[model samples]
Target: MDALGIAVIVAVLVVATTIGLWHRRTDGMIRDEAADKKRRAAILAAAGVETVEFPDRKSSNAVASAAAKAASGAAAAAVHGNDTVRAANAAARSAAAGVPAAPDLPADSGIAVPVDSGVPAPAGPVDEAASAEPAGADPQLAEPGVPGVREPGDVAAERKSGVVPDSREEPGVVEAAARDASAAGESLDQGLLDRLGIGPAQATLLQFSSAFCAPCRAVRRISGEVAELLPGVQHVEVDAESHLAEVRELNIWRTPTLLILDAGGQVVKRATGVPSKPQLIAALGDVLPDA
Candidate 1:
């Protein structure tokens, strides 16, 4: 072959290698987008604001929101000084301003005050319930300094989970699938299951497979074995090429995509590519009674 043909072959080889590496890098990743969406909605509700659904996981708006929340929490935590530090600072300022620091009083010191103020004291026993909180107002906010109530800084921190400044690892499917069942939003209806030839099943392991894919065979076996092991769980496989409409509607981007559905057909978990036996079992933990 001529040098030109040789160069062409080398370029094709490099391109193929790059594509294969990219595909291998992203294989077998399961996403828990439903839980992420619920968390974001709660944050918006707490702030008394609403935003359009996030375009995608990596959209600029989503990234900005996460960064802003993280920064706000770190700032709050840094500034919320301890009680001892605050007290010491108050005493130092009082000394500088020539104001006397108030004496610390014991908690059990029974003292009586003369009704010297213009306002008269209560005649009967003061109603603790009445003074506990204002009508229709939040008790915590009304008396933020009260001992048992969390301060605003702590509350803000609690709302946001820890944020890693820079991390590229994907979340584990098992960990994500363990979330509340309500967060699993995607579901297949009974009519659709009947059409797919899947009979009554407590949990369905629906897999989308393609003919040319080798990994699909392994996934088929794994899913079938799992279904047999777990009662009330049935394995159903679909040909992606033939079911074009279903693939498009379900957003099945790749072959061997597994969907774990509950008794009511809600998709509790999803994983793409070949999965291990333990991973599949863990993904089905929330849906199965004894798992």
Candidate 2:
């Protein structure tokens, strides 16, 4: 053979060997599903659970319903609390500056009267001072430097600005970074569970597999064993070919991707390939019932 042909053969062999080594090195290891925070956040957001908590609160409802209710309740409460804080701050600013704060108009009286309307405008300013509480009425909204009022740079303004404090940096939030990332977002709903012939449990071993993948059967066996051994846990196997939409939406790139979901159907961890029973149990520690 010509030297050029031999060199071409050598190059092909080298590339093939390199690819094989890379795949073998990572075949069955449990690792973070997404490569970066942004990707992980995107996955969670796509799953309709951007801020649901982990195994801390278990649920038997379908993953979607539980996660949606939790996210809705949390958002409503936060918005309500922030609005209250803003109203209080406005009142405090007016009191400190000796300005008359406008009285709240009733909901039904919100229609604006046109300038040429026959209705007559009020002749004088409202006597807010007569009906409203005096300055420093609520100790919590008193001016800065008071005994209990928050200073100028407190988190009240941060909350008002819609700046969410980093969940990881928040007090009492430390854990293995990978585990924490897994816990952040990604949930499945009840309807999907029903369609897949699975029911809700405290924790779910959700396996995505295809017909031709030999290792997928092993993963199924391991997941089933884990589910049987662990109370409140269920094993659910899905044929990736049959559920192409879910497979694509979830970014399931491999034949045997297993999603470890908490009781509320929030995905707390994910792994691809066949996993040892011990490793599966360890991955489930966060959602497992307390012994």
Candidate with best lDDT: 2
Query: In model 1, which residue pairs have backbone atoms overlapping below 3 Å?
Result: none
Each prediction's total of clashing residue pairs, residues at least 3 apart in sequence or on different chains, is: 0, 1
Model 2 residue 191 distance off true place after TM-score fit, in angstroms: 2.5
Residue-wise lDDT of candidate 2 within 1-291, one digit each (tens)?
Answer: 699999999999999999989878776666533223335555887999864322312223232232222222222222222222332343334345542222221111101111112132232311231112211122222211111112444334434444322323322211111112123334455556567676756678889999899999899899988888888788988999999877876778998999877655556667888878898888777555455
**How well is each residue in 136-206 modelled by candidate 1, as lDDT tens digits?**
01111110011211234533443343322111232222112221222234445445666666765667888
- Model 2, residue 79: distance off in Å is 23
User: Per-candidate TM vs. native?
Assistant: 0.46, 0.51
User: Clashing residue pairs in candidate 2, if any?
Assistant: 64-189
**Model 2, runs deviating above 4 Å:** 32-182
lDDT of each: 0.47, 0.49
Candidate 2 to truth, TM: 0.51
